[model samples]
Target: MPNNKDLPVSPFSPLTIGPLTLRNRFIKSATNEGSAPGGVPSKRLVQFHESMAAGGTGMTTLAYCAVSPDGRTLPNQIVLDRDTQPHLRVLTDAVHRQGAAASAQITHGGCFTFLKPQQAPRPLSSSSGFNKVGLMSGMLRKQAMSEADIQQIADDFVRGARLAREAGFDAVELHMGHGYLLSQFVSPLYNKRRDQYGGNLENRLRFPSLVLRRVLDAVGKDLAVVCKYSITEGARGGHTAEDGAAIAQILEREGAHLLVLSAGMNVESITTMFGSSFPKENRVSSNNPIMAAAMFIQSLTAPKVDFRELYLLEHARKVRAAVKMPLAYLGGAKSLQSIEQVLGEGFDAVTMGRVLIAEPDYVNKLEAGTSRDSICTSCNRCVAMMYTPGGTSCVLGQPGDAQLNAQPAALI
Candidate 1:
């Protein structure tokens, strides 16, 4: 058996997944940048990724590229289709010019789609279900996916992978977590079907497994294939850490080049996936009072956690033990020491989202020994702006930024 002790020792050490070799261990985790207008790459999106590439992330993920039209969380999200190839190539070329590898996160929104009626007739999911995100984002109807729908989605994922490869991306990360379409099928909380696609863990793993198979078949040898899966849904009757381990093994078995272990579902544990908090006072300005109240109540009732360094490390470790594939540790990694600690623990690499958002040149800073910690205080202000039309920016640095409305500061 391969030993964790035999892995790369330095955060700056080179690592290989499939045919791609990363300059370092710092990967920019996918955070939805609301910059793709009408599902096309905009200047803002290009700049957002180019800046990170220049800043020194080994690989910067262009977040949330939906496989199909109805599979978008945000209406303006990038879609991996024929028309997007040229734009995606531009985005990838920008990252490559900066001496960084580019990765695209491909997903299907399922019942979580935030499109208008004109955009799609209705949203889709593993089975007929209420659109939880719809309730929050203002749409509230979803149709259960037929077997044909499932097969088509798998094909779409394959096409998306092909598009990512043709676009010059070094890798593609499949978003099988956060209660998106794949996770919707994986989690019992969302998937309620009597067919072979639902019920037990093996049944639940069917659709996502098929999706992974198609993606690998499409571009397995040409580009590295990484999968980000939730370790726990954190909801009763949802997924547990053990289930996550099994899923990780399944992905590894299906030939995933790497596994990025993440946690939480959108409807069940939004705060868990995003380390943001929803204070009672902030709910006053919410367009959906009912959702705001529900979020507030959930926040009060859920486990209280102060954002700490390596928040998801413990749960991720369990997944690490279950699979031999290179695992990218994500969530709450801030300082150089924390990163070193994770490397020391035998995780293949560390993935950062908010840290890079705050300090784009974070990896360069660490290499230069210029700083030990990030400027972000886990304020989650950037997180708030991402949901709005203004796109993502640092609240402290970019004050009066019209996109992030005048909301009170995030709690540390």
Candidate 2:
């Protein structure tokens, strides 16, 4: 029912954040590429990002760059270290050549590390507890982080931001969402400790606040600092939409340059990431039938919601009203109409995952008046490839289809 002319602004318009200026409002959302191996960026990784940049995204975020070895989701996730700086620089240079800024989503996977015992000594979390998703998927061990360990992880975040700057990144987005270490501390579902790092709202937000403060102190003026955080965990006893708004206020007060609003945890709201239907075959480990059956039963009792355009706007609007800082709206942005609607609502920008995976040059096509909607179809098969040895690709697309193979992949 809405058109581009109904909007007062254009998604293609240039915008400024601190000292950096992006060419447009379309940000390539931080979808894991699954191309890095041994914490080093490979040629395939470089080429993949280059294609996104060349496709006309205002900025392309390199996803899941772990702040430390123990914090990684997988053994092969990119780690900020001396050995990987050169390769990161090359990736940044390649993005710049295609006229897009580069950003790194720095995070720690928490208890979600589904690696063998040989690969990781133990998974870390806000408190010691059984991780339902991890336990169901085969992760057998996790440990509560000590006070010293907490401080070390925060310090590691500062060091990661420094590496991002050295590698010529225009921005670094702190990953405080999707059941990661920071989000674990914030959620009541995970944090049951009586220490200063747990309990009430302020206590729960302590570690994440520390990390944000340290990162800002290290590179506040040098590069833009963005944080992608959940507004709601989408379960009882977890955070509500109101809690998310308060968290946004804290991030803005702590000097985050931008806030990318997201929601859902791995357990209850896994469907929040993938609209309509989740690819069960991609999510449940095929080797583990117990995990599959558990997921099936969970899906039956879970909430039923359809995947529609701009699905996250209602929740993101709460954060937008609570804080005056720039905000980037993500989730279910698959068409030119939806993007225009977001900008019209006063959101500073829009980010896309599945759509971009299916059509990397979607923005260019929209700008050229060649297309108004992406053909992605929201199958989310590309998301499955992240867990496999091969890199991410659209399941329906052919081999050598630019960067992401034409086959469908799952996203979570």
Candidate 3:
């Protein structure tokens, strides 16, 4: 257990992040809720975030809001656009009513998508290569992004941020981590380009930096612009801890309001990011059999990492020393003790996913001193729930709960 002594600030303290101020330092990190159907936020999705707000989180993030239609990792993922702004507004308003700020995580899947050619012909990525995840959907390969593709995606990020502001989001978290489009560009393991956008750290960062600058220019005044990126890609030849710190410094220079420091890649080193081995029972709930099979096969060889409290603290501290911008630590924070320890370590805030999913009101319990630790066992069943018809939920909760059993939305 972390000694809670000599902490500079409590997790309950308010934090200012550029244009927005959180009521407390605890933020519910982005977790794809799989509730959006037809690329629009559903009523359940609104209620999902509302629960987090009411439970006492300073802010709750709507996860994986793709910047463009073709950018979605799944057909049902929400897309931030004119057509969905009203639905998103409803979500943000609900969070505001509970006195918690709302954040939209704007992202592009890049080559990580499962869309077929008929749906997303020529899916673009940093460099063209065989796409293992896309193989199940017949999207066997990805196209190396051309100059026009790069500019168009950057424009899409601007539009997404603009729409997020229109939707009443207090912030827009640009997802540059988790082996997504931006992450692909940053990792040498994925980016093998010989053009100006490749070959070195500065070149790899060029595209993501462009996207961040464009979004900040468009909505930095209206909403806090948070950039979440991996501090380490967690693979042998991928971005290292030093590269992560350099990325943080560059982002600070680029004017990101806050940095959410994370690690690992969804494609190459997911367990390293989450600090847990893949659960064997994870195959039962997927709506897509092909994806289920892929996950199962991957699990067989997925690197095993024992779950530990504050898993990313060491790497995050390096980033903290490299940049003066406010930093949010994400990964393995499950208790008030851990949260306090992270804050004491100089992080401006702590972002949690599994604990929040396990108990939406966990923060409230901590503030009241009613609970010192979360009941989450880190079984990772909730991770599997992300692909379920009902979206992510704690298996420890009662089965067949209506909110956890919402009818599956038809895939676009």
Candidate 4:
């Protein structure tokens, strides 16, 4: 085992992510609190990001910033069209105040969007309908994208990357992970057409790759370009690890600066987001032991499968072997041991989402060697907030559990 301390340099060694240089390898991965309202970031959002900055993450990503009105998962997601540049500036400025790179993830929800058709919400997709998880009424309204519409959306991504640069953001990430619009276009199950933009893998990847080209051309080698990819789709007949490695290679060839990998669908549905049927033993996290027992009890009904958990270091190793780009492994990545293991296995960085919601100073504690006690419980209450009614706020940080998000989980 490679000790992080024994390395010739420091674990917090300097590294670059595009035009921005991070002082450390730890990143506060994009877990949104739905802090921004109506596409504009509020004062609370600024304070929240600034807090993460002060905690010592070299870079922090603003999760799922919608690229156009039609792409919003909710009204609270940040908007980055031509009209919203000024609002983004506030977020970028706050991130820079504490010497962290502010990265905005551009996305289009398409079939997974909750926008209203009456509101002229034009959901784009290579095929139609939501994933295998059925529909959420207005949320799954399918809108097949025309060639012209595809061109416009691709242009919008290019333009969004430009606006992120103008707003003073150090890096801009393209959200291709989860079961969002972009991931839908890339999945064989979601894309079933024979058109130029559907069917086989090449056609399935056409839209995302085209958008990447335009965005790269727009960012023009100055801005740091990162892509958050979904390695496991977590849906029946969805994408697999082999499929994702191929996708990562394509993105790398298209000028992606870094690859951030994760699994699961949206947070709107528990089955999709939590990956319920993945054989309980296969999940690695707090739920694993309990799930393992359940699996043993239910072995008669469940098919035999490997016990490798979704968010642990084992999966990261699998992904590292498949892709050459520096990997920012996501999903259940909360422990320092796991972080070091990822680096030792050849992954370049580790990203934490819900962990930061629980412990803002997570990286600081790890760097100081005083952080074995991280606060994230992996109860996934933060995940609940993503689609919880009025909008996602930290219930773990409220009242009875006022300090719940700050309490450390016991290592097993």
Candidate 5:
């Protein structure tokens, strides 16, 4: 097995993300396990991050914190309203205690929120409507975003950032990619507006930039701001890697400290979040054994054409050349050697979702030079449905009652 004893240790350098200094470049990409409920952090969520930090991640980001109520894909997805701060403090404290910087990703679900109906449903692209994604029910109603509503949502991002800071988070990442609310506004497939918020590149990017400005004002330069933008949305007719770089440039000009590059928005129906369109074989936690064949068939014909959150090798290189700001990449990277290569290639950092979920100690294991197969099978079971009945819990990540203790963050 791979362990540090034999492998070359890529100098565990000190990396600065905004004002925070990380011991290493390994970051736990935000994975929503439904640990937080009602938009508040649960005890289980605290433990989840604590374990990841204790396992030695340089930094970790809180995934799926919705900026607006209607923008949620699952009811259990954390809501960052006035009521959420109380529960968030616990999780933030846990991350800090373990010596890892904590960042919160503020997202808006737009029309795909089957979780909870937002008090307001302002769709950026009324023509295409909200995207219907995997294991989700009901059609998302599409409504045009008024200038007034746009302004409000932008302001809401600032509000959410302020709350994240108050809860003691080290940084905040705006969820502008992945066909979410901001993504809908920026994507060519979703955004079809003629106003200042749409049209040319400048116009299409207006709202996102404005939101960043507001967040900066509310949080100040003392706070590190990050934006996770799409490199190339999995589906066609969406923004490309080139467009992703332009968005990065916009965020940098707006004073963002970092940009996280992600790809394949709303491609979960065919591929898993890790971008694995199909697995090599049926394993415990991957796409169900029975349904797995269909995905394998799809992969043979259209692996690169369709979105797969798998390895980011194909797109990260393109993005690295386009912008100057520090870039972090997220897809489904599981190989330690591959991760080292990704950073060596130009990505400032690398993130893992299910890989980390399957092994929260992934960073520490890599540091110690341990070669162990992840328990997760790339099944996408956790994401098959928004949130399991109550909050969220990964059956594969948190196997049986024994795994439950290791996954306390699911209590909410």
Candidate 6:
């Protein structure tokens, strides 16, 4: 039998982050499952993470749990609050029963939401500007956040973290990337304010830093506080790799227990994050005629980048060199060799999204020597399918798969 005894570190090795210790170094990166319909955790969502835990992942992160109702990118997105706490507890208990830790990725959408005009009027962002992403929903403009708004949002994050702790989550990942509310404050392209919250890199990081500090103060001792941020905005005028390293350092100083290194802004350079374009035919369709037409037009102009293994390694390496905090490398990690390489290079963990979606038992298979790499094609079809009523599923999955057939609650 082949032995991993001589390997510097095995992917199955335990890893410590703050007060928590994971069974292994493989983390299921937060992927929007869309199983939470009407902002409540569904049975499908519980089964989803339960499968990952039973399959041998160290931890699985639930994606984009909005800190407040207005933070939702979509109406059906899960919100961390009292009403949902019981449901979230059930989900977390299911994960714990399988012997794996669960994490909640708390975030806010900012100007990237499709909320109806009557519901939001004007979405809040770092600076007032046209909201191209929300134009189809008649949300044409975004409002710059006031000082009170910033403080309120920070408090919301703290409340969310505390709720996650009460709900039994082992960690809370603060989403400060992907052009969301916090990323809006971090990115120069979105944060154009003349005040202390804008201008230089330090100023742009002000609000995000504030949010991080507050959340840590509230729940840092109870749950591992992981901060996921873009190492680069993946666009010409956005934050670069150097800026990402600085951001990592600042986050580390603010008491982030782990830093998840990611890249690309969902608004302008999403392909940079996924490492490929959404297949034209697989572009998410809308029920609204005007929105559907707008989506079709946008599909024609969407940027494309060829997929590659370990696509974010270069950027991650830059951040790794700058901070002493535990780092989790995200993006394009599919093979056992790739995970081993990342850990060897000093990353504390490897986070996988698409691959896990394709094969929830992938880590178990690797440990059993039944597989060397994930069977996932990284086609990103699952990205589009996330908006479907049944939520994300591998197109290659055989018929009758539970995840492929789950009926989630309807969105309001």
TM-score of each: 0.89, 0.89, 0.94, 0.81, 0.82, 0.93
Estimate, for each residue in 348-398, the C-alpha lDDT of model 4 and write its tens digit. Answer: 777777677777777888888888656665555554454333233444564
Candidate with better lDDT, 1 vs 2: 2
Quality of model 6 by C-alpha lDDT = 0.86
**Per-residue CA lDDT of candidate 1, range 1-412, in tens?**
8896776489988999988999999899998776765666766677788889899889999888888877776666778887888777777888999999999999888887656533346777887756776656666767778888889889989988898899899999999898888988898888899999999988988999898888888898889999998998777888888888988888888888998888887667867776556544344433434445556666666665567778888888889889888999998889988899888888899999888888889889888988888897786656555644556766557522333222211211
Query: What C-alpha lDDT do the candidate models reach, one value each?
Result: 0.80, 0.81, 0.86, 0.67, 0.68, 0.86
- If ranked by lDDT, best first, what sequence of candidates would result? 3, 6, 2, 1, 5, 4
Runs with alpha carbons beyond 4 Å of true place in candidate 6 = 1-7, 117-121, 284-298, 398-412
Judging by TM-score against the true structure, name the best candidate. 3
Give the higher-lDDT candidate: 4 or 5: 5
Model 3 pairs in collision: none
lDDT tens digits, residue span 1-412, model 3: 7656554888898999998999999999998886876776776787789999999999999999998888888888888877887778878888999999999999999888876533446778899878766756677788898898899889999999998999899999999898899988998988999999998988999999999999988999889999999999888899888899999989999999999988998777878888888777787766677658767776876877789999888888899899889999998999788888898888999999989899999999999989989999888878777766666788998432345335322122
Q: Tell me how candidate 3 scores on lDDT.
A: 0.86
Candidate 1 lands at a TM-score of 0.89
Q: Which ten residues in a row have the lowest lDDT in candidate 2?
A: 403-412
Per-residue CA lDDT of model 5 for 128-216, tens digit only, reads: 55554422344555677777878878887888898889888888988887667787778777778877777766778788888888887
TM-score of 3: 0.94
Error of 5 at 200 (Å): 2.5
